[model samples]
Target: MTPYIQVVTTVADRTVAERLAAHLLEQRLAACVQITPCTSWYRWQGAIEQGEEMVCTVKSRRDLFPELCRAVRALHPYEVPEILASPVVDGGESYLHWLEQELRPAKED
Candidate 1:
């Protein structure tokens, strides 16, 4: 079987982060999501800047990434939201299996 994965999305606001978390889980795009509050430091146009943000760590099967990404894009409030996905190289077999099962579409037999 293919690897399960965890995608990390950092949003500019808490409400947007919560909404994205809800949308992904409700649509079965993710098995679980963890929202974290973070102080973001970066450059937007040119100068260095900082802001408050919330990050969502979403767990799912890697195969569902495209659909999951699409869902985030559709529901995201930002003009360009940070959607980052990473491979789950190693983990518990049962947990990975569950991730796959959770991400599988109901329309599939």
Candidate 2:
């Protein structure tokens, strides 16, 4: 497995995406979160639906995936949110090191 991964999820609105991003950063679950607006089409409840959405890309270490999934699910509004992780096959050595550092949990006394 690769040392890093990017977790992607779509939210109904920009506000939701921003909130989720902020929460993840505050929790140190992600090194960075990028939110982008896009149009999406998919089937739900046997019906095809189309809407404007915000896509959130969360960058973090591969080992933190489980926790990242749980965090996104807890903050996501959709009953069946689209959460997927793609491995970073190769990245800048310094950037990868920074990502790993950012995801480390805070030390407790």
RMSD of each: 2.4, 2.8
lDDT of 2 by residue, 19-99 (tens): 999989998889999999999999999999999999999998776788889999999999999999998999888988888
Q: lDDT of each prediction vs. the true structure?
A: 0.84, 0.90
Pick out the ten consecutive residues of candidate 1 with the lowest summed lDDT: 100-109
State the weakest 10-residue window (summed lDDT) of model 2.
100-109
Candidate 2: residue 57 lDDT (0-100): 95
Model 2 RMSD vs true structure: 2.8
Give the clash count for each candidate: 0, 0
Candidate number achieving the greatest lDDT relative to the actual structure: 2
**Which residue runs does candidate 1 get wrong by more than 4 Å?**
105-109
Collision count of model 1: 0
